[model samples]
Target chain A: MPQVTLTVNGKSHTVEVEGRTLLVELLREKLGLTGTHVGCDTSQCGACTVHLNGTSVKSCTTLALQADGGVVTTIEGLAAADGTLHPMQEAFREHHALQCGFCTPGMVMSAVDLVNSNPQGLSESDIRHGLEGNLCRCTGYHNIVKAVAAAWPVMHGKETVAAE
Target chain B: MYDFAYEKPTALAAAVASLAGDMDAKALAGGQTFIPVLKQRLNKPTTVVDLAALGLVGITVTADSVTIGAMTTHGEVALSAAVQKAIPALANLASMIGDWQVRHRGTIGGSLANNDPSACYPSAVLALGATIVTDRRSIAADDYFQGMFTTALEQGEIITKVIFPIPQKAAYQKFRNPASRYAMVGVFVAKTAAGVRVAVTGAAQGGVFRHAAFEAALSANFSPDAIAGIATSADDLNSDIHASAEYRAHLIGVMAKRAVAGT
Candidate 1:
């Protein structure tokens, strides 16, 4: 077994894992951070999307040993200590972006990274294209696209949400 | 996926040695493609050599060429200002790969090494006449790719970098298969100092290949109209569930023209 250390969601943990153990498995099975779902088990589904060292990657394809000593931010790490949702999460909720909510975690995780990387502001098509890896079986992506647009303004501190 | 021992070698030599010492070992790059193969139990290596710690991620640009490190991710390439300025078409092609998540982890060297028949990078390499620098030697792009999911790379030979000559004008056009998004018929056309080169992927059975007729036509005159009258033969093209060989051949013509017009 390979002993891997990960700083996940701002917490550090050293655990033993098999060489074939995936990063998503480490997060969900070992650390109990089940917010990162394994929708397809393959890399195609973005349900296992997470931030590895400030960039979004599909955790299902990332090996545990490959991510050793790296910092990871999962869907669980997005909110504040007081339980305030991230602007993307808030927008998803406010605009009714999700229906079954199965894809929300990865969708929101990928969306935040998209907004963070593109400070110039994302258009509707950009959001749709940006979220191509994340498949939402419900809501038809209309509201999800709307939520990403609405959140970008607030995320960049150009506009305030929740009457801030 | 079968359980295997993993080694992350900090030095390139050590990484190569680790792989060389074991016949059942395989080198792992970003593993965007390999992992999926492993999940399906398609490949079962006894040992996996992790290449992340070898410090093989960077992009360098000169007046004529851009050299990208082997471990450089597609996300990094797509975002690189130098790459964007030097070869915007290459950057654009990288941006259109698998997806945002895949781009973050998929490496150019990995894609080239795997040499999947329908992969996008090989078309660029073939069209641009790039050089694949290995741990031991530099191989020309023309001689690097052999066939589907195959390359000239030896068992333990690692790709250190890829050197691509910046083209005067270049563009890639891909008709994506709606579901897998793999290129149904992708064409990359480049007008370099040497001459015009057109490489087509996804449609060919023998992997990416240069379109000599289009190249000759476009070299005489660089425009969609120049290659409009020419037709590609469907004899050696791939025909699977997604597209027929005839359809792929037709798409090659349309895509080649589009690539020329865009460039």
Candidate 2:
């Protein structure tokens, strides 16, 4: 077994896990951060997407041992310290970007990462292409694209999350 | 998950040494493929040597070629100025690989080493005549890919970098699977200083293979209309739920024509 210490959601967590333990399992089981869902064990689905050291990665395809000493931010940690919803989360809710909410956590995480990287704003095609890894059986991607654009001004501090 | 020893070696020699003592030891690169296989319990090694700490991430462009380290992530390659300037077709191919998360973690060396039949990297590697450098020896792209999920790598060997000769003109066209986004019918066409090389992925019976017929036609005329009359036999192409061998065969021509047009 390997011992891994990672900073998740602004908290440092140390756990002893098997070498084969996936990072998603470590986040959900060990740290009790169950916001990151595992839909497909294969890497095809981005349901377990999270930010690793400021970049997005699929937790299911990453071993916990590989995340040792790295910084991981899951969906649970995207909120404010006092439990305020992030702009992306609020945009999803306002835009009705979800159906069953199965892929919300990952969708929001990827969207945030996308808007964070593309400060100049992304087109609908860019958003769709950026979130291609993330699958949503519901919504047909119409609302997801809206939600990303809705979150842009809020993310860039150009418009208020509440105003949007 | 199985219990095993984990060692993150910062040096290539040290990483190889960790694998030397244990026959069941595995080298971990991008973890895009291995972690999923491990989660499915397809592979349970006693030791996993993580190469992320070995400092093998970079893209170096020279006057004649570009060498990408084994650990360079797909995202890094896609966004690399050197790669874009040296070979935009290669950069475009890298950009189309998987989605955002997979691209952030998947490495060129890992994909080439894994030798996935539907992967996009092998097409570029073979089309551009890249050289695969391993810890033990260097193998040319022609000799690297052997079969499905197989390569020239021996047991415990690790890929260090891949050196690709800058082609005179090249382009890759892929008909991706809707759900998985893997290439259903991908064709890479390159006109190098030596000659024109055409490599097709995702439709091969074994793995990525060179299309001699397409190459012969392109050699005669390096134009899109030149490859329009060429026929690709369906006998050796793949057949499954995504596409039939006949459909894949049909796509080979369409994709080859687009590739020739540099689309």
Candidate 3:
């Protein structure tokens, strides 16, 4: 067993893991941060996406030891400590981006990264293409796309939301 | 997945030693493709050598070539300004790989070493006349790719970096499989310093291959109309539920035409 130390959100924890243990398993099983869902187990579903050193990576496919000494931010860490929802989460709630809600956590996590990385702003097609890894089995992408567009302005700290 | 001893060596020599010591030891890079295969129990290695600690990640642009370290992720390459300026087509090819999450972790060397039949990198490498540098020796793109999921890599061999010469005119056009987003037919057209080369992936049964006929046509004329008369035979093309060999053969022409036209 290898002892791996990683910072989740703002907390640091060292955990022992087998070589085969995945990063998702460590986050869910050991740290009790089950907010990150493992929808597809395979890399297809973005449900396991989390910020690794500020970039989104599929945790289900990442080995536990691979994340050693890395910074991770899951859905649980996305909100402010004051209990205010992150802009993207608030956008999802405001625009009803999710239903059946199975994919919300990953969706929100992925969405935040997507918006933040593109400081220049994103178009509707860019959002659609950006979120291609995230599948809403409910097929409710119209509202999701709308919600992402709404969130973009807010995420980039612009006062007025995009008119789209 | 089998329980294997994991080693993350800080130095390249130590990493190579860890892999060379055990024949079953596999080098883990990015883990986009390797982990999925491992989860399916398709591969079992005695020890997994992680290449992350070796710091094999970076990109450099010289006068006429771009050098990318083995561990440089697709996301990094796609987002790199230097790579975009040096070879916009390469950046375009990288951006279209897998997706955002996969791109953040999938490395150029990992894709080359795995050499999946439908991968987009091999086509760019083949067409651009890139050089694949390994721990031991450098292999030309022409000789690096062997076939589907096969390459010229020897046991315990590890790729360090890949150097791509900037082409005067180059573009890649891919017809994607909707479900998997893997290239159903990808054609990279490049007018390099040497000559014109056209590399096609996904459709070929023998994996990524250069189309000599299309290359000759484009070299003489450098236009889509030049290859309009050339016909790609369905023979030796991959046939599956996703695409019939005939359909893929047709796509080869369409994609190559688009690639040449810079669409």
Candidate 4:
């Protein structure tokens, strides 16, 4: 077992892991951040998406050792310490972006990074193209696309909440 | 996913030395494909060398060519203003690769090294006549790719960067497999100072290869109509469940025409 130190969601934790341990396993199993779901272990589904050093990457494909000493932000980290949901999460909820809620966490996480990358704005096609990594089997991506589009303004600080 | 020792070397020399010292060591760059292969137990290595700390990530554009580091991710290359300015076709090709997460983690070097039969980068490299630089030597694009899932890379020969010559006109058109986003048939057409080059990927059974007939026709006319009559033989193409060999062969011409037209 190798000891790896990671600053996940603002806190630093040092833990021991095997060489084959994946970053998603470390986050969900060791750190107990189950919000990052592992829908597909092969990295196709973005259910295991997370932010590593401010960029979105498939956590299932990332080894724990590879992320050593790096900053990791999962779905749990998106909310304020006071419990206010991140604008993206709020927008997802307001837009009913999820069905069964299994893919919401990863969808929200990936959406936030997508919006952050494009500060200007993202069109409907841009949002659809950006969300290609994430698969929502239930929503058919209709409302999910709406959620990402709705979150854009709020995420950019142009609006407080998604329009009703 | 087997138990393997992990080494993260801070220097290129150290990384090379680590790989050379162990015959069973494999260098990991981005790990978009390597990790999946590992997880499936397809490859078992004694040591996995992480190349992230070597600072092998950057893009440089000169008047004649664009040089990209080995570890530069597809997303970075696609979004780079320099790459877009120098070769918009290459940038567009990068942008069209596997979805956002994969693009964020997949590197051009990794894609070229793996030489997946359906990969998109090899077509660009082959069409652009790029130079693949490694720790040991610089290989011309003509001699770099050998076959499917194969390349000219010798053991412990780590790719350092790739230099692509700027073309007067170049474009890549791909018909992607909806599920995997891998190219069912992809064509890259470039009209360079030397001549015109048309490379096809995914459709070839042996791997990416240039279509000399299409190249010749386009060289003479420099238009899609010139190569419209050129056809690829289905006998030598790949046939899988997603696409028949004949269909892939037809797509090769369609995509080549689209590439030449820049549509």
lDDT to native, each model? 0.92, 0.90, 0.91, 0.91
Clashes (N, CA, C under 3 Å) per candidate: 0, 0, 0, 1
| Docking outcome class, model 4 | high
Worst 10 residues of 1 chain A by lDDT: A155-164
**If candidate 2 were superposed on the true structure by all CA atoms, what would the RMSD be?**
1.5
- Pairs that collide in candidate 2 are none
Q: List, residue by residue over B145-215, the lDDT tens digit for candidate 4.
A: 99999899987888999999999989999999998899999999998999999899999888999999998
For A76-100, candidate 1 gives per-residue lDDT tens digits of 9999999999999999999999999
Model 2: CA > 4 A from native? A162-164
- iRMSD of all candidate structures: 0.8, 1.3, 0.7, 0.8
lDDT of model 1 at position A24? 93
True contacts kept of 2: 0.96
**TM-score of the second chain in candidate 4:** 0.98
Q: Evaluated with lDDT, which candidate comes out highest?
A: 1
Residues A39-123 of candidate 4: C-alpha lDDT, one tens digit per residue: 9888888999999999899999999999999999999999999999888888778878888999888888889999999998899
| Highest DockQ against the true fold, candidate | 1
lDDT string, candidate 2, B1-263, tens digits: 56667889988999888888788998888988877777677888998888899888899999989999999999999989899999999999999998989999999988987899999999999999999998999999999889898999988788999999999989999999998888998999999877889999999878999989889888888998888887889997899988999999999899989999973
Q: Could you give me the TM-score of model 2 versus the true structure?
A: 0.96
Instruction: Count residue pairs with overlapping backbones in model 4.
Output: 1
Clashing pairs in 3: none
- Which portions of model 3 miss their true places by more than 4 Å? A160-164
Worst 10 residues of 1 chain B by lDDT: B176-185
Chain B of model 1: TM-score?
0.98
On a 0 to 100 scale, what is the lDDT of residue B148 in model 4?
A: 93
The DockQ scores of all candidates, in the order shown, are 0.87, 0.81, 0.83, 0.83
Writing each residue's lDDT as its tens digit, candidate 1 over B10-90 gives 999999999899998999998999999999999999999989989999999999999999999998999999999999999
Q: What is candidate 1's TM-score against the reference?
A: 0.99
